[model samples]
Target: MSTGPNRIMDEFAKLMTDAAGAAQGVRKEMETAFHSQAERWLNSMDLVKREEFEAVREMAIKARDENDALLRRIEALEAKLAEKGA
Candidate 1:
């Protein structure tokens, strides 16, 4: 009364396919819910995003460069003044 090898394999294949489909559905739902929650939390926080932070950092670097140039100019002016006084 036992089934043949082919029938057993067919049943097993069906079971595996059903399990894979169920897992995919669960993954999609979890991904959607996670994104929704993450967006809400990110919006609630008044934080600068990565892009904005990077831009500000670049600006700071540029400002530092300009400040260094100004310092060099001031030193040169002071040196000239000392020579004139000597």
Candidate 2:
């Protein structure tokens, strides 16, 4: 009689363990599917990735800085020319 109850308890514990493992697997599958779908949808929307946006932003900043430097050079050259004329 004692052996029978112990056997039943062992079987129940194994079943619970299997159930927990299956639940974890299902959870992982669900998370993967959700992430895949989200990425696909975002791509379809044609959004710029962060890296691309940052690159473009850096280019624009560089161009602006160059423009400022060029403008200052032109102004200095004009001042020299005016001094020579006077």
Tens digits of per-residue lDDT, candidate 2, 1-86, equal: 44788989988999999999999999999999999999999999999999999999999999999999999999999999999999
- Superposition error at 73 for model 1 (Å): 0.3
**Per-model lDDT:** 0.96, 0.98
Model 1, 72: alpha-carbon shift in Å? Answer: 1.4
Compare the candidates by lDDT and give the number of the best one: 2
lDDT of 2 at 33: 100
Model 1 stretches with alpha carbons more than 4 Å out: 1-9
Worst 10-residue lDDT window, candidate 2: 1-10
* Model 1 lDDT tens row, 11-63: 99999999999999999999999999998898899778899999999999999
Candidate 1 yields a Cα-based lDDT of 0.96
Point to the candidate with the largest TM-score.
2
